[model samples]
Target chain A: MSGGGTASPRHVITGIGAVAPTGLTCADYWSAVLRGESGIRTLTRFDPSGYSATVAGEIPEYTASRYVPGRLLPQTDRMTRLALIAAEEALADAGADPSAMPPFACGAVTAASAGGFEFGQKELEALWSKGGKYVSAYQSFAWFYPVNTGQISIRHGLRGPGAAVVAEQAGGLDAIAKARRHIRSGTPLMVTGGVDGSLSPWSWLCLIRSGRMSASPDPEAAFLPFDRRAQGAVVGEGGALLVMEDAERARERGASHRYGEVAGYAATFDPRPGSGRPPGLRRAITMALADAGMAPADVDVVFADAYGVPALDAAEAEALAGVFGPRGVPVTAPKTMTGRLLAGSAPLDVATALLSIRDGVLPPTVHVASPAHEHLLDLVRDAPREQRVSSALVVSRGQGGFNSALVVRAAA
Target chain B: MAPFPTFTTKQLVDLLRECAGEDEAVDLDGDILDLAFTDLGYDSLALFNTVSRIERDYAVELPEDVVGEAGTPRQLLDLVNAGIAERV
Candidate 1:
């Protein structure tokens, strides 16, 4: 794909960081991504005893004391710990300090569907095993609501404005969308992204009850989004953080910008279970393009929200055909490598899309041997493809009827 | 896709030691929650982490609700024994 023209209202990504199965930092994650390394492994975090789902994408050998200092390690859950680590990396990468910058100018936001389930499960297990007497007091705060955003804010000393968006899978992209709005409205620097760590026994049980988990035991065979034999999506755990700043602020700071801007963001709701494909998400894509002042033809690549479910895959394909026409857009789903990070999924895609725009390379969607649907969308597989991308459209949807689209542009 | 025998108490102690990552002497007859967890310095996070390791090693799902009824070490042993029975 070649660039048609330049995109406008560029929101610069000055900092990118994450604590993921690929790696502990954005540099490590990006390198692993380029090499196409798989992080999925057997369930080692807990005994799956009677549970059917056996595999997961888990962060290997993560210790909070290594990333976060000794003092704050005990107070935060693993999910928050990952978020803080990523945020710290991003802040350091951006070379911005809230104290050095204007007061009330730096704020933070995070996307999260659930926080600290591993911690919650442990406490609950204690409660059940010991009749509440052994339930640790720390569970109250460790399992506190929106703990990721709170921990990130406290860790970074970011006090401008903080919020946690809850849209299940779309939370990450929506958080970035909100951060872009924050940067546009008033705040100079807004840190945004999402995190999830729900692989604990209780959490895993809950997800199993939700009936969305892929039952395939083999990691490679599991989570084949947009593939014919795709069962259901697998669960992965991690967090990614981005330091988004106003284009003007970014330029003034002399920060090396990766992408042009978060030009537009639009979300739609698709209520009613088992409804045919996501027309709501398709409308969201069109709306986001309109918000970015671009057309479907202007979008060079598409980071697809391939949910790995047959119904969802079909819906998204139809929606893409309707929006971008039968010619189709280049679509890639990298989450197939890490399973779905739930809330963290969309932000990772957003980051991937931004990186793609910056480097003029399309990351491949692995494990997809064939296009699951008849739709004409170009699903890049196996290897990276060269593309002169000016604008990229990233679409994401959550199971609970939430859909969102974000437009990212190449940095001039 | 693998199976292992139901763990004996000695095997469980060894597993617990390996899972817990420390040499805190466990009271096998005492409260599993308090002794194996709190009093033994294993916090909730650590306990869950240990449980996750156990589940992976055993390839079993210790039902959250099933474990809730156990408090004493004997009770936990019985719970694990029953889970292993059901799976086998």
Candidate 2:
């Protein structure tokens, strides 16, 4: 559906740069996801034999020196390094050089939850094992949640409207929404989306403690979102970054490749538990559809926020059913392959959704062969489905009652 | 006691290499004492880490301001050696 053509300048995705356990770049990631390759495995960063949620999706064949400068490596963390690579790829893909444009015409935004846990773990290890003096002074900001934005800005000379959001998984979508705001409010281009990770034992402890993580050792049985034997999430590292620019700006720069338009976005916080009010997931879905000036039928596919937990999964299913009828839309969770990337999850899903729009095929939800119980949803499983995906909805939720929904429709 | 020795350009360069990667253009073998850390491709964070290493290696306590104030290797040598001299 063409988003009201003349009302407001649309924010369109011009480029994608993503890294996950499955693939290192947007093209590779899309290929792996469509081919239904599983990247989930036992955690290898550090021995997790003693931990419950031992499985994770780690980026394959990634070498830091190859992607980031050696000087920046000492000052930055793994998350920041990954983000820098993604940002550089995105800039090149868009062909919109920041140094060539007015400083205020470009911006950067990113999201974080664990905030460089791998790096923090290293520093803390040095602190305890050795002494305080051994701690790198880079610890001051290397572990900071917003360091990705700051580092990206500095690296690319992006001097406009920098911001960072922290809402666990939902933050990815929120960060993209913020970038879209900057694009609408006169900024021509924004480096946005999230490349997040928390794969360290230190952050792993926190993730496992949340009781939302799977304790299963088997990769196939672990982190299943909707299946009967579904366990909790298998935490993963790395997400994705996207280059979103105003349609007119893209046209001017001759970077006319369009993934889709960020047509609508809405976020809601779930009321305090036991407050008697309903969960906000349903409301967020409804409002996002309304914001896009579309009805429930307008959406062709849904990228689910599939929390593998039984209760949360049920809630999300009910929300989808309330918006679309039972089995109304094709819903998939390609993340089942790479596990959930916390703050990185939604942006990865957003990138996958755009890819789905690009190639008329919907990626499958691996391992979840059948629903746990009779649910009013059509789960795409095992193999990718060939479909004409014009508009898609991406749903994401954070632990602290955060619910966010974004609508991206095929460019007119 | 003998006069407290100031850190040499070689020592600072060593610390700089440990803090960040070694830069090829910094002319480490020649005179680099007065060269600004920025010119040597050392950022504030690198300098801070270098200071931590220096404090440990020399058993000195540099002031908090040294990381920002010491732009050149010579400046860092003076501030850190001055702190060490006070103790000696």
Candidate 3:
């Protein structure tokens, strides 16, 4: 339970930065979450003439020059640009010397669902329209791959073992889990989370083919994850980076810490169609509780992954009913207001959960008229709710059938 | 979306500024690189955002390379007009 020891599972978050539909930084994002402000806006990133979903939680006022150098900005796809900004903020908040830390001891693990599709599409269109020669050399590494981790490592001099997790939406929590494992295994520090930007015509065309995008033109009605009128999810883009380090090391360094423990993590896959959750999601929650060395009764809140799609929402509700067993744990899906961040979504939810623990308040799920299911969990709605949150569970499931759950505890 | 036509430099400047969501202070002939996309005072996200706006307002699907090629207002105008001509 201490640093400098060879055997300890303690991982403390030293700093955090998030570029969400809510806001650009942790504080601003958290504040917007409380106010129930929706970042969903009309499609300005790409024309939606032929698309089914024309709304998203687009990050407004994002300029690479504002965060990254103009010269390097052109080389980086929008995804990496967002990641770098979040990483820069997290590193500064941690006060870790990117230069001073042992390059091998400081590591990074981040996740992405769609990768750099916007940039990839630009290059792909050029190739399609003007032949292969028109494709930018940058496209070789920028699009649809897990290069955000590599890009962050290169830009920040983090030479430690870097990794990219591709678990779809749950990839965000999965990346944090991986970072915690590295820290436990003696990596001094790790920058971890999810970042992505895929709201482009190329990406949209693929999403439309999948038949999961919301078709409603009304912004409020477009992404109703747990509502009677719910159609499907709204695609969003952004990134969140948390500077995680050994708790003892953080204290020894007199570093300012945000939250206490990652506590628990579990992942599952529900591959079979119409099987609901394939029993894996419930098992994942149970495993996460066990990993936290706590019982389901110990959790103070549940951040549910209300997928908006009727069938998936039912599966999640069933999973919750089986695990929590009528405990009526207060649950919320603030992402309803901002649209889902895909790979970046769940980590932002985790961040919101952590901030809720810190602030002793719960954010509301905007626009859900009534609980979508009769599971009757205490769902926060319309406005922020005051609560004593000691520990919470955040859950998410990806499009290609990946499910993940994590337990986070407040600093004791 | 309206079809674009050959425009004078003043009209080109206005079109570029409108697409960029900025005012007329933008240099119509200056190096676009030196003018940080922000310095041009375009709304953040407008670098790519203006492409969508230009396409809609001018009814032209500009080439993706336009971001790299449209350094001056004249270039943007030329690109739009050329696309319009092709469509016509």
Candidate 4:
């Protein structure tokens, strides 16, 4: 696959920040992942007694006041607050100050699925009961999906190519891909990732209506992806963002704490099963490999989407088999411990993939003692598997036929 | 008519401090007269809310243009004084 265009500059992951279900920081989250600890527990944001799924991956004991000032709290929702904190951490980790850099040279792109649903719900309650005048003026901006990108840009003074991706669960990967494009096209740096908290009754109800949520009340079994008992995924809340920069620029700045390089990425749509077309995940994986100038054998580990639905699981397994041949690759879905964070899911997976490359260890998929897929792929379970991970293939499938694949390679 | 209610510099500073929240970096002894609300660690929205509270408490309507033009505590105080004099 050749094209008549300037070769894009290599994009490297210089920093990582996360507010995940297991922990608030990337180190804590990675520690929990290595221990195979599950973040899924009984829902405390709201009463789930009457709901189908009573458990979810809720952030334990999160206090936004610790990160956001009181003056700005009313104007920010949980989603934006999480994004702001994660972006700050990522920038600090990269030793890059947006204020010190040319404002237009720095940019941001984020993914949001249910834009501030908790805040919007409050405004709607006020409108329905206390009348329109009682609704908050902040609602006008805080409840929008693009508000995450807007707030991050304003807070950091990043005037460069700012945007948001709303591709459902695949939006995280899409946002990273867009960030890579922006960097290659002249933007010096970008803060890109995804964060969402939809555990509120209104948000959870919306998720339940989609028929994808697991009805199990057991926390451990609620989101058993790729397991025979996999009913469906439990909705989780959290997000992770990364600071991506040009490889040469980072090295020139003497930045030593590098995670990995975003080698390649590709996206496709599944278009339902019976459109007389093949599954899109396999094509997306193949294209991503080609984009990275790599082969199937070059990939050391596969980060499965692990939707926790029977049909979707089978389809994903088949796609993996088609790419790497029968049981040709080691696969894992660490999201089993974090539930499915919707838009935040893929970004967190990307973060974990980078960490896997750094540590040369494949994080375990929690609570999968028996492999469910008949294809017999090597699934990492029980404990972290030690391996020389040079490249990782992270794949995600969204609700509305969105399939995305990203290849992250160990730092050069 | 009842004597127009007047605020001392200290009272005004206290009000600003209260409106800005305890966590804000509002300096009571610093150049409050020249410092912008943002410099005092209050965003534009917070300043608006503070202005609204001042109007309700003082029974005077601040001019609409004051929201954008009043960058300093001195400008805000002048606007309130003008409103008081006009009512008188």
Candidate 5:
């Protein structure tokens, strides 16, 4: 096949930043993942005694004020604050100076499944208890989904295209994909990813209604993805963002670190069960591989969504079987330890994939001692797998049928 | 009658530095009588917080109208003085 049109400028991840349940920084999170450590524990953010789920993957110790400026604290939600910290770290990691680039040559794109739920809940409480007059003016924008993109751009003086994706669990990949598009279209750089904190009473109540969360009180077994005894997922808090830059521009800027290249991306939707169509995950994976001009065999590792629901788990395995056949690829779901972060999950998976490619090691799928079902796939478990991982495929499926897949290749 | 509590531009500068952070370039000795809050790195939200802190310390509530009208430190100081006088 002849390559048409100067193939869109290749995009590379120049920097990565994460605020996950296991750790506050990308290095800490990746270290915990390699050690097969689980961040799940008893839910102390609130008294879960009244709720069905008592365990969660909460960040060990986080103070938003530590990262956000005091002047901006009143205007920021926890989610936005987390995003800001991650963005700052990613820019530093990439050694990107937006001011050095043309002001309009850099942009920001963020994914947010739940926009400032904790902040909105607090505002609602004040309104109900103390009347409208007591409500904060910051409530108007802090609870907005696009507040992260706006804040990150304004803080760094990025005047290029900015957007926020709200595709639930799939939104994180979508944000990264959009950032890649932006970089291809003349933007030199983009700060993109998803971060969320929806552990408040109201957010938890809404999640409970979805019927996908594990109510197990035991932290070790609460969120067992791909295990025969799997119940459901645990709602996790925190997220990650990445600094994506044009490969050539990064090189020109003397950036010494490059995580990986965003080779290709594709998104699909699962029709309702009765629609008689194959699972959308298979299509997403196939499309992503094709977009990357790669074959299934080119992928070194597969990061499964691992929703932790039995039916969903089986369906994902079946999708993998259809794509790479039974035991076709080495698969892992480190999220079993971090719990399900909703939209924030996929970006962390991408970050993990980049680290895996860089270090040539695949992190294990913690807590899955027994195979959930018969499948033709090598599921990494118990201990980390050290191997040559030049390219990785990360997949995500949102609750409302959104499916997305991304291909990350080791920087050449 | 009790004496009215007074506020100086230096005190206002100090409050801004304390609330916004000492690293922010809030002119301490410059002629800030006509400088807007934004000039001092104070957005509307930060300005509101500064006003709240002053209210808490002075035991007086600056009117919402006064807050909206006071754009500079001098204007804010005048409003605070007026509020303290009314409260006393």
Candidate 6:
């Protein structure tokens, strides 16, 4: 449980940067979440009316030029630009200067489930309308899944061990788990999480192919997780990035605050259909608590993956029911405010969990008035639950059955 | 057919400025014709996009390695003008 055969350094999240649909910064996003404001509305990026699902959780009033250098604008995708902005905000919030740190002491690990779909769609259009040569050379790396890690590393000069996870929605927690590995393996800092977008028309076409996106035109009715009206997820863009620093290093560097500690993490995969084995979420939850040297009762709140599909929602409810029993724990899904953000959503939930631990309030699952799983879940709806939150468990299940659980607790 | 408009040094400089965007730290308008693109803050990727822009804008295709071959604005201009001449 230690790094380099020494005592395991406590890996704590010192800073957070978020670019969710509801808000642009960590403070703004938290405020919007607490207010129960929904960012889901009609898609203005294009005529999404032509598509089955018209509403989306696009980041409001975002201009990449304001955050990124002009030189990087033409080369990077909207996804990477969003990540760069978040990383900058995170480093600034953590007050850790990578340039001032030792060589190779910092790293970055990000997740990307939909690798620059907007950028790829643009290039594909050029190829179709004109020719292959018209495609931007930047497309080579921009559309690739790991470019977020590469861009963040390059931007922040994080030359330490770096990686990118692509396990769909589960990828965020998986990415954070990877960051913990580096922190435990002696790396001092990691800028980790997932920010993803594939919101263009071409990618929209591909998204519906999964049969998981909600086709409802009404924004309020589009995503009703744990409700009978639950149709499917409204795909969203934007996520969060957090600065995870070793405890001693954060203290030595005079970091202003510790958001929380990454107490434990575990990931599992659902058994394929027709297999006798059960879904892995319950096991993941149990194993993560054990890793944190805590029990299920110790968790204060549960941030669900909240796949709005009825069967998936029921399965998640069943998982929570199995772990904490029906109505044993308070559960919420603020993503109802900002649809599901693919790989980015889980990390957003994790960030929200840390904020919950910091502020001692549980953000609500908005828009789901009637709880279909009231017998199975103490779903925190409509109002912020003002309770002391010390530790939280974030549960996420990616497309193709990737399941992950992460435990974040207040610093001891 | 008349050769595509001559790819002049001024034109290349204008394109480079447009490609990389006019940044305050590095002046794309200075005496940058002989200086390496990297020295001018235009990395390989920037050069790639500039080259791609040149191709699409002028409708004259240069060799794929034109970017690799042209390290400076002058070199890029030479390659682009040659491609323009070949379009005659």
Docking class of 5: acceptable
- Regarding DockQ, does 4 or 5 come out ahead? 5
The parts of candidate 2 lying over 4 Å away from their true place are A1-6, A373-375, B1-11, B22-34, B62-70, B74-88
lDDT of 2 by residue, A1-412 (tens): 2234445567789988898888778888889998899999987878998888788998765777878876787888877888898888888877878899996878988999878888889999999999998988888889999999999998889999998999978999999988987877789889999998887888989988898998899999898887777778887877888899988878877895798888788899999989999999999898888878889999999999998998998888889988998889999999998889889889999989988999999999999866863567899998999989999999999998999999988987
lDDT tens digits by residue: candidate 6, A1-412: 3222247777789989998898888898999999999999999888986788899998876676778887777778888898898899899999889998888999999999878888898989989998987788788888999999998998789999889998978999999989988888899999999998778998899888889999999999999999999999997888999999998888887889799987888888888888988889888888888778887899999999899999999989999999898898999999999989888999899999999998999999999977889999999999999999999999999888899998999987
Estimate, for each residue in A226-247, the C-alpha lDDT of model 5 and write its tens digit.
8888999897877789999888
Model 6 stretches astray by more than 4 angstroms: A1-6, B1-4, B17-24, B59-65, B82-87
User: Which lDDT value does model 6 have at A312?
Assistant: 92
Each prediction's whole-model lDDT (CA): 0.76, 0.86, 0.77, 0.84, 0.85, 0.88
TM-score of chain B of 1: 0.60
lDDT tens readout by residue for model 3, B1-88: 7644654556544544543334345554555533545456543344454555566556678897787677645566677778878877
In order, the TM-score of chain B in each prediction is: 0.60, 0.86, 0.56, 0.80, 0.84, 0.85
Per-prediction TM-score to the true structure, in the order listed? 0.79, 0.93, 0.80, 0.89, 0.92, 0.95
Error of 5 at A84 (Å): 1.3
- DockQ for each candidate? 0.03, 0.53, 0.04, 0.24, 0.27, 0.54
The DockQ-based CAPRI class assigned to model 1 is incorrect
> Lowest summed lDDT over 10 consecutive residues: which window, candidate 4 chain B?
B17-26
Docking class of 6: medium
lDDT of 2 at B86: 83
CA displacement after TM-score superposition, residue A209 of candidate 4 (Å) = 0.6
Candidate 6 chain A has its poorest 10 consecutive residues by lDDT at A1-10
Of candidate 3 chain B, the 10-residue stretch with the lowest lDDT total is B15-24
i-RMSD values for every candidate model: 8.8, 1.9, 9.8, 3.9, 4.2, 2.0
Instruction: List residue ranges in candidate 5 displaced over 4 A.
Output: A1-6, B1-35, B48-68, B84-88
Per-model chain A TM: 0.93, 0.97, 0.95, 0.97, 0.97, 0.97
lDDT of 6: 0.88
